[model samples]
Target chain A: MSGHSTYEPKTGFERWLDTRLPIIRFMNDTALDFPTPKNLNYWWTFGGILALMLGIQIVTGIVLAMHYVPHVDYAFNSVERIRRDVNYGWLIQFMHANGASMFFLAVYVHIFRNLYYGSYKAPREVLWILGCVIYLLMIITAFMGYVLPWGQMSFHGAVVITNLIGALPVVGKSITTWLWGGFAVDDPTLNRFFSLHYLMPFVIAGVVILHIWALHVPGNNNPKGVDVKSKADTVPFHPYYTVKDGFAICVFLLMYATFVFYMPDVLGDAINYVKANPLVTPQHIVPEWYLLPFYAILRAVPNKLMGVILMFAAIAVLFILPWLDTSKVRSMRYRPTARLYLGIFFLACLVLGFCGANPPDQPILGHEPSGFMLLDADINSIVWLSRIGALYYFAYFLLVMPILGLTETPLPVPEGISEPVLSHPAAAPTGAAAAPEKRG
Target chain B: MSKMLRKGLALAALGLALIGGQAMAASEADEPRAPSGGWNFDGPFGKFDMAQLQRGYKVYREVCSACHAMDLMYFRNLGQKGGPFYDPKYPNPNDNPYVKSLAKDIQVKDIDNDTGDPVQRPATPADKFPAPFPNEPAARASNGGALPPDLSVISKAREGGPSYIYSLVGLGFNAPVPAGLTVPAGKYFNPYFVGDVSSAWHGKGPAPKGGFISMPPPLAPGKVTFDDKTPSTVQQQAKDVAAFLAWAAEPKQEERKAFGLGAMIYLFLLTVIVYFSYRRIWRNVSH
Candidate 1:
C-alpha cells in the first residue's frame, strides 16, 4: 500500500548498486516508502507478527536440524540427546516447536481479519490466493516437520493422513505405498519427511515474497473498505507501521516464550512422547490443535473418500471466497445480516474443533444418541454433531453469503477512512465502536 | 416479534450444540492421575539436587540397569556438567575415578588396532551403555513378547512422565486387584501402567481396561543401598530415580529458563520504546 516510490539514491555506492540490481530501490519501496493505511487497527499487526514467526522458525529449525538424526530407530533418542547433551539445545527445540504453533496462531488471526474487512475483494484476489497458497504450504511443512521427531503420534498421524490419500480410487494404494516407501510407515518415510520439512520453508519464503509483492500492488484494504481518496488516507510504512508492527511482534514473542519456557507440553500431546510402535495405536488418536477443524470435517462424513474431498474442499472454498461473497459492500461492519451468519459460522468452526479433539466414540446427549439422518445419510453419535457444524461451515459460504447479499440492508458506511474518527472526538472511545458512522 | 424469534432460535441452536459437545468431552476425560512430589526439580525455578541424583544413579545401576538399556548415554556423561559424578577436578570424564572404574567394569566390542580383527576389551569412559539384549527379537523373546524400551528419554517419552514412573515402580507392585478384576495367568496388575491387557479388554466390568505391565515390578523396599545415608525405601528410590530421569529428559532446563528471562526483559523494554515511537509517529497523521 504505497504511492509512487520517492526513494532516490544518495551515496555513490547506493547509486551504482541501484543501477546494477535495483535491490536498494526494491527495499526502499517495500519497507520505507510503502504507504500503509493510517487507520489500520491492532488486527492489522498480525501480518507483521506472522512474518516475525516465520523468521524465528527458520533460524531455530536450521539449528535443530544440525543435531537431529532422521533414522527411525535413533530419531527419538537423537531428539533426547539434543535436549540433554547439546548446549542450549532444549531452548532451540522449544523455539522451533512452539514457533510453529505461534506462526499458525498469528496466521489464523490474519485470515479472520481479512474475512472481517473483505480484504479479498476484486483487485486483491490474487494476493488473497497467494496467501491461501502460503497457508497450504505451511500446513504441509508443519505436518512433515512434526514427523521428524518419530514419536508415536508423529508416526501414526503421518500414516493416518497419507492413508487418507488411499481413499482415492484405483491407483490410491500404489500412491500410498510410494508415499510411505514400504508396506507401512517405516524408516524411509522419516528420512524423506525430514528432507522435505527442511526444504518447504524456503519454498514458503519464495511464495511469501510473491504474496507481499501482490499486497503492495493494491495497497492495504482498510477496515472501512474504502479506497484511498487522497494522500491523507495513507502514511509511510516505515515510521508508522514499523513501530506499530514491531511493538505487536515483541508482545507476541513474549506470549510465545511463556509457553516455551514454563509449559512447553501444554499444547502438545503426551502420547507423542512415547516412541512409535506399529503394533499399537494411541487410545485417542488426535492431531495437533490447529488441524482440529479440518480433522473434524474429515471425520464428519462417514465415507472415507467423501470425507477427504470435503476436508480439501473446505480449504479450496477460500480461493473462491471473493465471488462467493456476493455483497457489493465489502466490510461486514455495514452488513448486519452477514455479520449474524458469520458469528454462527465462527462458532460452528470452534465446535468442529472441539469435536475433532475428542474421540468420536463418546455418546452424545449424555446417552447414546444415534440415527439422526441428513440427505439420506445416518448421523451416528457425536460424529454426527460435527456434521451439523460442517454443514453451517459450508453453508455460510455457499448459501448464506450469496442469499444474504441479495436480501440484507447494510448500515451506512463512512465516506473515508478518517470520517468516523474525525467526526466524533469525545463520543468515540474506540474506532470499532464508532464503526458504520453513516453520513447524515 | 418475528425478528426476536429468529434470534432466539439461533441462540438456542448454538447453545444446544456447544453443550452437547461438552458433555461428550466430559465423559472421555479418563487420563490416570499420577503422584508428583519429593523432587528437587519440580517447577520452572527448580534445579537438580546432586546428592539425590547420585543415589538415583546407584538405584539405576543396581536394579533397573539389569533389564533396561540407556542407549544414548556415554560413560563419560557421568562426569559432564549437570550429572551425578561431575567433579570439577576431572575436566575429562574418562580420567575421573568414578567414571573410569565404571567404564572398566564392562567389556566393549571393538576392532583390534594392529590386526584389523574384531575384538572385545574393557570399556572406556567414552563408550555407550551396552545393551542387555543382542537384538529386538532376542529382547522380546526374553521378556515375553515385549521389548524393554531404552531408558535414554523415558522421562520425557511417557504420558505422565517421572510421576508415572514413580507410581509404576513404587505403588504399582503388590496392590490388591480391584473388585471383579482378575489377573490372567502370565499377567500382573499395575494401575499406573496401561499395557497389552487384552484380558480386561474382553471381560470389562467396573475395572478399567488395559492396566497391566510386564517386567514384574523391578523395585522393592530395599533393592538398592543408598550411599549418602538416605533411606533405601522403594518410595524414596522411586522419587530419586524420577528426579534423575527428569534431568535426563531436559538437562538444559535451567539454562533455557535463564535465557528466557533475559530475552523477556529485553523484549519488554523494546516494546515500551516502540509503543512511544508509534504514538509520536501517529501524532501528525489525521486519520
Candidate 2:
C-alpha cells in the first residue's frame, strides 16, 4: 500500500485547487507516486494493456453505434456499408470487432498471471472479484455486440444461448421469452441487445474504477510474491511502469494492426457474412473464441439443465478462487508441485477451447468410428475430450488447489521483495549495483 | 442539399437497398478446398489489375447481371479511386465519361416527377445498379426456389474470397457427377458446393465431395469478349469476375493497406523508442 502524500503545491492556482478538492493529489497518489513493486515483470504489463483495450473498445464502439442501425433487418447491411462506404469505417469496425478478442486475450493473461503469482490471495481478494465482475460484464457486452451485426452466426448464436435459459424446470420458457422480448430472437431482441451492448461498457468502466481502487489499496503483487518490507522495495509508478507498459502496448498494437489491416476477417467466420435467417440455422453454431472454453464446458454435460448450471458454475468458481486455493505459499514459483497442476489446468482450458470451436461429434485423434464407443459418443470424439477437459478444469480448482496447498513442499521464499532482487543470479554478478538503496 | 449530406443520404439509401436485396438461402459449403486463384489482390501489397477489373465488369454486366444483383454498388463506384474504370484525371467519378456512359446504358426503374407514375430512366453515375428481380420471391421462383445472391460482397461473403468464386464457377461446376449420385431435375452438380450428398448418393462408401446448385454452369469458353484482348477462357472469365467482386466487396481495401503500412512503421518506431526509454529509465535501478 502507498504511504502518505508526497505532493506539494507549487503554484497559487494549485494551492487554491488543492485546498478545494485535492483531485490533483488524488491522481498523483494513485497514478504517479504509487509505490509499485520493483520486481514486477512483463506479465504485469497486461493490466495496462487491458485498460488500453477497454478504452479502444469503448471509443470505436461509439463510432460504430453512430453509423450502425440497430434493427435486425438493417444491422447486417449497416455494417457492410460502414466497411464499404464510410471513411476509415473499415478500420474502426475491424478494430472494434477484433478489440473484443484483444480485450479477452489481455484479460486471460492477466488472470493466468494472477493464478501463477497468487495475486488473488489475502489482501487482493476484493480486487480479483471486481475483475471477475468486469469480465462477466464483458462477456454479456461482447455477446450482444456480436448480435448487432445480425449475421447468420450472430442471430443463431443468440438463439442458442438465450434458449439455454429455457432448460430450467418451471419458469424457464417464460424467462427466455421475456429475455428475448418475444417467443424468439427477432427484431425486438436485437433492439434490446443493442441498448444493453451500448450500455454495458460504461458499467464495466465503473467496475474497472473499483478494480483499480482495490488494486491500489493492496498495491501490486510481484513475481516473487513477497510483501514490500520498506521504501527500498518499491519504485515510483510513472516513469518506470508507464514507460514499460507503453512499450508493451505499442508492441501489442503492432499485432492488432496486423489483423486489422491484412487479415481483418480471419478471426471471424465466413458464415456470418450471410444475413441472419430465422427459418434456417447454420451447420455449426459457435460463440466467439473467447467464450469457447465455457461453451465447451456447457456442452460437455449431455444434460441440458446440468450443462447450463455447469457453465455458470465455471465462472462462479473463480469468484471463490482466493479461498479455494489452499496453498500457504502465494506464488507457484515457490510451490513446484502446485505449479505443475497449474500448467495442466492451463492446458485443459486450451483443450476445452479447441473442443468448443468444433462440433462435438468431430474426432480429435482420428476419424470417426474409432472402433471405441463411450457414453453417447465415440471415445475419440471432441465431446469425450471436452468431458475430460471439463473434469480437469473443475478438479484443478476444487481438488487440486485445496489438496496440493496442504501437501506440497514449497521452495524457500524470500523475506521481502528486495531480497529476491538482491539474490537473483543477474544481481549476484553485480551485487553493489543491485543492492537496495535508501530514498530520501 | 450540402454535398456531405447528399453523399450521406445516398449511402444510406444504398445501405437500405443492400439489406432489402439480401439473399435468403445459405451458399452451401465447399467440399474440395478452393485452390488459390493467385489473384493480383492476393497479399498485403497487392493491387487490383485495372484491366482485369474492367474485364470482370464486362462479364458481370453481360452475364451475372441477368440473374444476380449488386444493390450496394453505384455506377459512380466504377470510376472511383481503385475502381476498374477509374481515370486519374477524373477526381469526381460522376465526371468520368466512361463511367457516365456505362450508367446511361442501363435503364433503372424510377418515378416520373411530372406524371407521378413508375418510369424507366437511363441511369446517372450516382444511381445504384438495378436489381435483376424486383423481389426475393420472384428471384426464387425464376431460379427454381434458389435465389442467386447479391454479388456486391460475394467475394467476401463466401469463404476463400475470389479463389472460392473462381473455383466454383470455373472448375467445380464442370466436375462429373460421381457414378452413384443423381443430379435432380433442375439442380446441377457442383463439386465445390458444401452439402451432404448422402441422400442423393446411392453408390458410394462416402458421399461424393459436393452438392447440388440450382444454377447451371453459366460460363463457357469465350463467354464474353474481353476489352483488353485477353483470352476469354472460362477460367479467365471466372478469375476476372472474382477479382472484380473482391474489389467491390471492399473498394477501400487498398487504402486500408496503404494506411496500415505507415501505422505499422510508426508503431514499430514508437515501441523501439519507448522500449529504450524504459531501459534507460530503469538502467540504474537494476531490479
Which candidate comes out best when scored by lDDT?
Answer: 2
Q: For candidate 1, lDDT tens digit of each residue in A226-330?
A: 777777888889988999898898889789988998778778887777888877766566788889999888876656788789999999999899888777677
lDDT of 1: 0.78
Residue ranges of candidate 1 with Cα displaced over 4 Å: A1-3, A364-380, A421-440, B1-38, B91-95, B114-120, B195-205, B208-210
In terms of lDDT, model 2 sits at 0.84
Q: Name the runs in model 2 displaced over 4 angstroms.
A: A421-440, B1-37
Docking class of 2: acceptable
Worst 10-residue lDDT window, candidate 2 chain A: A431-440
Every candidate's DockQ is 0.29, 0.25
Interface DockQ of candidate 1: 0.29
Query: What is the TM-score of each candidate's chain B when compared with the real chain B?
Result: 0.79, 0.88
